[model samples]
Target: MESTPKHQQLLHLLLLTTLIYLSSAISIQSSFPQEALPTKSGYLTINSTSGSSIFYTFYEAQNPRTPIYDTPIVIWLQGGPGCSSMLGNFYELGPFRVSFSLRHNVEHLTLVRNSGSWNRIFGVLFIDNPIGTGFSIAGSPDEVPRNQHDVAKHLFIAVREFIGLEKSFENRPIYATGESYAGKYVPAFGYYTLKKNARLAKSRRLNLAGVGIGNGLTDPEIQVGTHALNAYYSGLINGKQKMELEKLQEEAIRLTRNGNWSEATSARLRVLGTLSNMTGLATLYDFRRLKPYEDDLVGKFLSSVEIKRALKAKESISFEVCSDLVGNALNDDVMKSVRYMVEFLVKNTKVLLYQGQCDLRDGVVSAEVWMKKMKWEGIGKFLEAERNVWSVNDELAGYVQKWENLTHVVVMNAGHLVPTDQAVNSQAMIEDWVLEKGLFATGQVTQKPSHIGTCSIG
Candidate 1:
């Protein structure tokens, strides 16, 4: 207490040094993430409600635009409520393939070039969501959503977080694109984003531009009705088999009318089974494949020691192409219709509905039937619009029709996976619509310009 002037001077010096040190530390902390630019395969962890950790990867544009801010981002979701978006990555539109022979083994696998990557024009994001799907982990069973709304909310959080972390995405136009079950997820997420952006106008929640669903299972009641007709017209079912399919469809319709989603789903599956069980050579997802995806290929590649290390993935993580546990948990949600969400999207932005010509699972006709009936803006114009052939490099790629901002396309010679079957053509279609509309040349008029029904362009 009775210190000399010298002691006071030393104390003052020490106080000054500490403050300088603290300031320097704060500056360093602020600049900490200047670590080398993140790689294309970067992870995004979304802390979702009910305590779930959603995992996602952004494969920056395959051919990213310079000054990257000008480029666009498209989030790609896989169909299964539990399926890994990695399926879209390796098998459909991502830049890399698990292996040349994805049919079986990943024993000597490599990441080969995918000519059909959507990243050619936009930065692509793949998410493993719904708590326990793919490589995503849930803190508990409570984290998993029991309904479509909850799942979309989690993804909404994820998208906001992604924009915050990835500065490059802040100003770019974004799209929500998915196939199969994604018909529901894409629209739900799009509607959620639209509402969120409206509330937070000062915030740029993905600069959402549009949504595209490819051969998706969106409206089950309307879509399931097309199965019997799809079977008969595709020459899979005879007149008698067609009649039997009609019975299954009628049963499904009755169940749906009575609010029995589970049974309705079962009935729809039976309608699909009419063709599957009879053919002994059913390629519901594809006309070329006899069996389902080779799940082992993705499992082995993703779970491998070297690959995981490269992506900086967690240790002791298991990978599933589609998680039955997650699927089973959301079984009821999947069978319900998301037409309202689609209606909201239709009124707001460009809505692209693409169907693969060969898909028996949620084919083109199902989408066409419901879309015409939906009470969205311009439905009547869409109903009466004439079809035109869109040629890619002077070859027939698909048939396209436009009504206001809504676009409906039926890709020729493709199955459930349009990009996988018709990568170049698919790219041309997406690029034209999303970035430069009315860019591709028109070819010989599509078959029955009166109907724009179906014709091979390739």
Candidate 2:
């Protein structure tokens, strides 16, 4: 009951004022999101294998937005090993287009207005992964997946639970989409889901439709080869480096052809990173040449401090010490605990492989090489037609090459994150493919804008 010191009393008063201001600010901010959107978004939580809970921001399609649910439910997965789907959400293809500053207000783009957002005909899901990404948390380190198979299992289970509880997305077509290292992740997860679906088919719980891997890392050998070839052609290599890479490629191919995949794989993983100008665990798939702001609008979007803060705060538990952990082991020697997903492709799960011309990491070199080798018994010419309505050089830039149902596109001037770099093209490609129509089959696909306003070049 002693009288408070003047300074102490002043401090208390300041704290009280600050708290009130912050409370009102948060309330106002919260109301803004709900008020701005034509449709209201809710939240859903699911438990992972380790009992850690994962949170998802669910934007329920409104009556006007109702057609979206009937279309496709796209679950986007970004590939940082430590990256969040939010990267793809805001920077790439989410409903809300983030502002230039990472720490400022966002510019929300509606499907009706943009005609480019996937929300026009798909329910987009931006997930915070591994329990520590974004606001999501895991119960323990074990609850998180150190490998691809476990990640696929847990995520699918979570999605299943969410769908069940919502009861609105049960029969919706589900596709897995991601970029960069997701090259490894997307296929592995897709394979796991396909296998599990086969196992649980009679139970009728699984609703996986197909998979879309945009400039993904599905094959290790191809990834390294592409990196090396791209470096060599793009002048990232010099005399000795070029010589060594050529020799290494020959030797690796010899080993792979001779059934010595492990040795060849180890050699490639070791050399490709250096030759390709990559370093660290997830470096092989990063664009070493372009700094964030200088590249294009997409790069600027990806470079936002807001996304960086959110990603930097998340826990990254991926084992990317070697390429083998992320790519197909049969073609490489790097040993990762994750399972190879070529078997899944063999099982006829709809697989789409698209590439961006400027994605120096895992360029079309790899996808082209891999697809050529995919012995799909399905009927279709490798480069049959201009599947993408948005084609250049009669090449379709993107094409429906491999499987009858499976398709691939190489977006012109786009980078690794195709959707972000070329959202219109990417969306057009996806819409065409998903609807069972070729991207250019109609010969009436919308053309890319000649002028993109003040937006930076991507």
Candidate 3:
């Protein structure tokens, strides 16, 4: 049978359309650092309705083992409910640290090699998550997430798009990691991925392997209750001050229980502020420091024209360390707990929760309080597991406890930002956990169960 001229023309058009779609899908920009490890930066459209997108920077491992595809990929999210993950990239664990200098009263910013970069063994992806935060763009104010569910959905979409676009990332084991408010973000994202994967074909599933959180606020109710005791025991507050803080804590809890979310968030802030005023502490994040850690230089550098071009960031969007708009939009979510997500993740994924000993905000005491209240089946074995001393280069670094798929570490002499305060130790800790070396390898109480039950908190 002879085909008509119109049929031939339609076939040609279909082929052309397919080619254009394929090219665009894989057309990621790789125009970043030539001297640094392989790096790529781009934006993934997350919400078509709002024209919202998430900006991300990915650095391939500097020294991956044989069969590089086996090397894990870690996606890092910074907490502010509004903070940029670039802070995690530049200040904590990226290929390079941003060094600031003043020459002749002029400020200069330069990148210096960090000996403790997490990317030394694992590919690291830093994301400016939640529309309106950092370089991530939201077409309208309405796009900013108001709760963890939306935050998780956006993150999941961004990651899925990224992996589908970048062929190298396909089939690679991925881990969700972050700190601070990311504690909630990390678990929420992990749980969302697992739930989504359950319904997808094996080849289409995201290979989400584990989750790691450092000094995170996963449970505000329990964590907020610890501030007073933490202050009083640390000698920062006396009995009278402790009681006052306790009263404020109770109010916050009551508001949260009554579902006065925004009011509860305000109450929580007041409690923190009162504790700060009474104790004369420079910052609640790290009690050892007389002044708060600053990231002003980071913002300045990221917002620079040269960096915008290098990172392929939009020149119109100036970088911010923390987005107030994003924070305000999530005010009501501040006191909400994502502990259930963490509980679900521990049952099906390897979970690493670490706290810096010196961190008063989400430190060991606060974490321990929440852990005791956790209803996981493995809680009994985890509590009985010995906390072995973790050391780096023959020096005591922290303590590690492992049971089933759950691992906890207490980093000594560190603050809220473990990677920044104790870079070397934190790097070692992540490496060991991901690679199953050292304490993580030797500290298992029982082989991870094939099936685990769900848990809830009151």
Query: Higher-lDDT candidate among 1 and 2?
Result: 1
Candidates 1 and 3 compared by TM-score, better number: 3
Q: In order, how many clashes per candidate?
A: 1, 11, 0
Pairs clashing in candidate 1?
396-457
C-alpha root-mean-square deviation, each candidate: 17.8, 10.2, 17.7
Q: Kindly list the per-residue Cα lDDT of model 3 for residues 166-235, writing each as its tens digit.
A: 6778888998999999998999999999999999999788899999999999999888999998889888
Q: Lowest lDDT 10-mer window, candidate 1? A: 27-36
**Which has the greatest lDDT?**
3
**Candidate 1 on 1-458: residue-level lDDT in tens?**
86679989999999999998765542100110122122445445555443466677676765765568988888898887788887787777876665633222222555667787787867888887776887777777666777788888888887777778766678878888999888988998899888888878566555888999999988888888787777777777788888887888889888988888778877877877776876554478765566765645666667675565565556567878888888877777756889988988888887889998877788888888888778775787777766877677877777888777688888988888888789888887888778645632222222343233446433
lDDT for residue 301 in candidate 2, whole number 0-100 = 35
Off by over 4 Å in 2: 1-50, 60-69, 101-115, 201-204, 235-240, 247-273, 276-290, 293-343, 383-389, 392-403, 440-458
Across 202-236, the per-residue lDDT of candidate 2 in tens digits comes to 44555677777877666655545555566667665
Whole-model lDDT for model 1 versus the true structure? 0.75
Write down the lDDT of every candidate, Cα atoms only.
0.75, 0.55, 0.86
